[model samples]
Target chain A: MNYPNGSKQIPRSSQKLNSNETIFSNRGMTLEEDINATNDYYLDACLAVIHKKPTPVQIVKVDYPKRSAAVIKEGYFKQASTTDYNGVYRGKYVDFEAKETKNKTSFPLSNIHQHQVNHMKAVINQGGICFLIIRFAAFDETYLFQAHHLFEHWDNQFKGARKSIKYEQIRENGYFIPFAYQARVNYLSIVDQVYF
Target chain B: MNYPNGSKQIPRSSQKLNSNETIFSNRGMTLEEDINATNDYYLDACLAVIHKKPTPVQIVKVDYPKRSAAVIKEGYFKQASTTDYNGVYRGKYVDFEAKETKNKTSFPLSNIHQHQVNHMKAVINQGGICFLIIRFAAFDETYLFQAHHLFEHWDNQFKGARKSIKYEQIRENGYFIPFAYQARVNYLSIVDQVYF
Candidate 1:
């Protein structure tokens, strides 16, 4: 499909969509797609106003054609200083990052960055709800792990602890997010339970 | 200055800064630079956690060289579907759009998009503090116009009303944001007065 700007969509192998099936049943859908669909549902339902931030890019050069849109000729992605998703839910500020791991036993700390952890710490310090959405794709299980819980594990690694959070530990400490037809990754349910 | 990605900063005439003076006295600074500086101050002061969302880009092609980072070879900017700035303040959700106009008599409705208006309305409905930071560059004056006030002017344009809001009307309805040494566009003071 082509965007309004005349640029065609760059299809990713994991994001292939089948016309016959609903997004909720599209088992091959990546974690980002599910969360975006879920956020759209939440917006339409007036439950929340969350959105995935666009990828940050550093533009080096652009060419403005006579009558068409300006095209970026050179650009590079920048590391995001904040989380992937944030919004207001029930009059409360919410912020979170989502990650998908194929590893069967653990969610690696390498999936996150120190700057992101610092950002989340600042969010929590300001009284906002902050967390991570970790999806173990092999088991099709997604868990909502609060930021404070992740921080403890994050700091422990610097003290010679394991570099990843074990799946069993996540299962014990994080809330499991269930899939729904409308809200594919229904994380707000977990937010409602833990925050409110 | 060159970014970490090796992309040199594109010189914007209005954003040129002198090494001799602080940003507060940089009269030529655009509204965006002022707001960004203000946000940085707020972050360091532990007062707020707001950020301007990155410009959305529809990347069409990327080149991943052997040793360096991926380079976007072709891309087009996409219109954002939400307001520019958003974050948490005192545990409350805050969202806004910033626009600078050279018009002396009025602020044109065309400065904003319909989708942004819809997004702001949704945010207000969710009890988030939503507003517009309007700067009259000609007057060197800025005002924090609440989203609901903007909605009236926005909807009236479709009902055979003026296509722009009169300067006098904005002066009456919007809170004037005073410039400060640290907070160039000190809008949170208006938020504290109006919402808190």
Candidate 2:
């Protein structure tokens, strides 16, 4: 079936969900599916090459039921040491974490881990574009908040600053991702506006 | 304990295997370990931000015995669709696969999968740097062969060309990665020569 850009075939996993369905059920579509579809669109157009890192799993034991396939009998989820999505956009490194909140008023700082904040700092220090994609699921709005802005709030938290960032603050500092027909979450346009 | 790059502390996992051990047993050090150490050195020196993608696993069942932890009860390995290593180097996307051969005659083409070749092609098409790090273990020589050159050989195979690339062809076409005290496998230096 034809996808967003209609240039590349739909990914096997995302074949069941189409842009039309996503548009009709915007609230039902998870932020991840939207981003994944958007990434597929970007990839088809050769605009950027970004990918969400696979969830890390720590294996404890394995059983070799067959010579070719070894089954993991025991394992646990491991805390990721870096951001969810990262890649190159227009010959520049891009890194960011995607998160969503049901709360319409504020985004809780507790949703982000300390290590991830440190990782984004490292990426930014090394001259890479780093940011956070904050989605207010209740309002069906998503914003791209730069890492520097995120750091300012994160640093103040240790000095008794508010543990959550008000939605108004995000709206003020972040760029709104325009929802589009082909590109559901058109954040790269904002990346071009800010970074270019 | 000090690592090869004395600037950075030894990684927790590699603390047991110090530089001295790696140096003394160069033959014993797996290509994966060498590349990991090299990547760590690059990261510590702020030269590059590259990483090996985690082995993908397909989880079948999970048991949450505690509120804090979830144990995976059943899982299986999932074949990766891209190169093993990818990251940003000097604001450009870099993707590569590392392979080692005990064979003195030729590097076998069978070692690489078709999907990885396609992935590298896509990366290159999007203005990214993609290559292969082929190590002839017996000679302790590693070479950075660009994906284009690898592709030429790979494509010609179907037209009655050799199934494996000769060591002499690689020696002629690929840049040699100098062995170093700090970087262990100094492939980036060759990257500087070829790409920069």
Candidate 3:
């Protein structure tokens, strides 16, 4: 079926996670809402024009109450989006994906979708700035990894390499996004240093 | 209410046509979708990196079949969005709004939303490329009006000037984006000449 932006579902409903896969325990809110609020704060401060794309919810059913707000009652998880956040910066196009996990040792490969990885690679190939903002929420640390490096690791994984990307590997290959009061995730500073 | 980003909304609810209103008739497809397809052509040819943000729908109800997909059967129109298209080119961010009218003589100021106007101003202030692509479907003509000139006129219209911009005014204030076999709209060429 059709999803937002003509996204099609993957036929293979495959997963490495078992029936008892950790259900992504987190603080209080969904990782998406928190990152969205943070991005909103960043946008409000005029430190960056970045904004998170809407969650690609597959709207399967809805109830439009007369003179009331529409309430979503049923839906399915869509194919994870192609990009999490995108915006323009200093006249250049900037695009990225963001994810946070409570895992302490490494980020699980299952957290990312194949389509998103493909999209990030395409963005970089087309000469646009593309990266990812990865968070170790348990440690409260985040890093911005350029798309090229992500593709390298992702490709390696496809060839039967490590299933999880280690924290040390990220720290070595990724650019740490410096947190400022204004731009909470000031990925652009790193973008300037690396991609430009 | 949310729409992806830079996508416009047509208020099928409120439309008032005056004698001076410009008219543009198309093949019954959404201007947004058509432009999206056009942008895709541009992207494939390495001409531009633009996209239409998903149509923001405030879904109220959904239904999930046991083995089927979730369907959005009820929803309401979302608030008007900021712009119609935004992307990167040559390390620069490009942002713009697109509108089409059936009137041949003039385009109505009412076609634009206040928040979108504000967004264009902000983009300009932040040094991003901002503009409006006005298409007169009746005449099959489209022109790119820089946010600077549009803002000046839009602001003046609030005081006691033209409520609707004349076709001659658009010709004078805007640059024409040439249509091409590869790039269709070829908007980046205009961006290259004007913004870059």
Candidate 4:
């Protein structure tokens, strides 16, 4: 039930698509699950109000049954224009995307979208705390890489530079988020240390 | 193309389901559209980073082709647990729901869901700027009613109080958001006035 990172594995039998169970621990405690648990802990303690934006769906056809909620018979998942999670922390705007990579030496740029990069820039320009929660899944390590740092590497990609950030570079520039018991990923502590 | 409240109706011919057009002008520029335009203007000016949460959907079936993106074949609308619009403004967590009522005397409690009330309470308890943007369509009037003021009346509903908050009460407690040329609803200016 528990992973090496101290995250509890939620039972697959209890996974429900319509519920918060999307972030449950069945297929290895994904970086998302730990963050969700952390957000829940934060919410319970009145710490912050961060939430993962719901997956966007384009509804095409609907069946209006007799006296029942309308059922969408056809739809398509649409790519999100912003980051995965966003909210307020200590009276500051907090926004970030969580990405997992099994690659050992680097975090790939292709994992992120152009609009997401633009969104981070907008948030930063608006004086918000924006970053990337990069999980090197194979090594069980997570880092809070600031949006500006990511932007540097992203901009270099246009000049035929490396399409990924070296692990060494990330270790130097990014703040490591320690895996904790109740706090799970413990990224906000890094946010406080880095931003505050 | 302009509604009575100064919101511009997005041309129906240009509406796209998967686009932000869902929040665009139509139906005489619903309050949602005006707010969306204001949010867009704010984003462009690097003022704030507010966004309306996408409508939640419970996807039941999806199809994956060899070369294309996944397509959701069946889904159903899911009632949201939180407010419709939320983001960061002036380094503070800002959240609110926009509602329009034709009733001239009072804003009906039935217009809001119990879960939404609970969500607002949670945000306010955590030090967020929470409120309601209620528009009286018939009167061409709008008010930014704070969540705490709304909660007082909501709690009273269980103790045999009236099912609606009278317009006079809203006029006394809520800040009026003026319609502006470029920003549409100009709610953030009201936010700046009230909170900053």
Better of 3 and 4 by TM-score: 4
Clashing pairs in 4: A91-B91, B10-B25
Interface RMSD of each: 0.6, 1.6, 3.7, 1.7
C-alpha-based local distance difference test score of model 2? 0.81
Candidate 4, A19-54: lDDT as tens digits: 544442223888898899999998888888788889
Which stretch of 10 consecutive residues in model 3 chain B shows the poorest summed lDDT?
B2-11
Reference-based lDDT, residue A123, model 1: 94
Chain B TM-score (each prediction, in order):
0.87, 0.86, 0.80, 0.84
TM-score of 2: 0.85
Q: Can you rank all candidates by TM-score, best first?
A: 1, 2, 4, 3
lDDT per model vs. reference: 0.86, 0.81, 0.67, 0.80
lDDT of 2 by residue, A125-154 (tens): 677888999898877777889999999999
How many clashes does the backbone of model 4 have? 2
Docking class of 3: acceptable
Q: Between which residue pairs do clashes occur in model 1?
A: none
Shift of residue B120 alpha carbon in model 1, Å: 0.5
lDDT of residue A183 for candidate 4? 87
Can you tell me the DockQ of model 3?
0.28
In Å, residue A160's CA in model 4 sits off its true spot by: 3.4
Question: Per-residue CA lDDT of candidate 3, range A1-196, in tens?
Answer: 2111222311121224478766333246555665566567756656556666554555555667899876665554466436867876665678987889888889887877897886676567667788878888775566777788778778899799998889877877876555444445555666666755
Per-residue error at B144 for model 3, in Å?
1.4
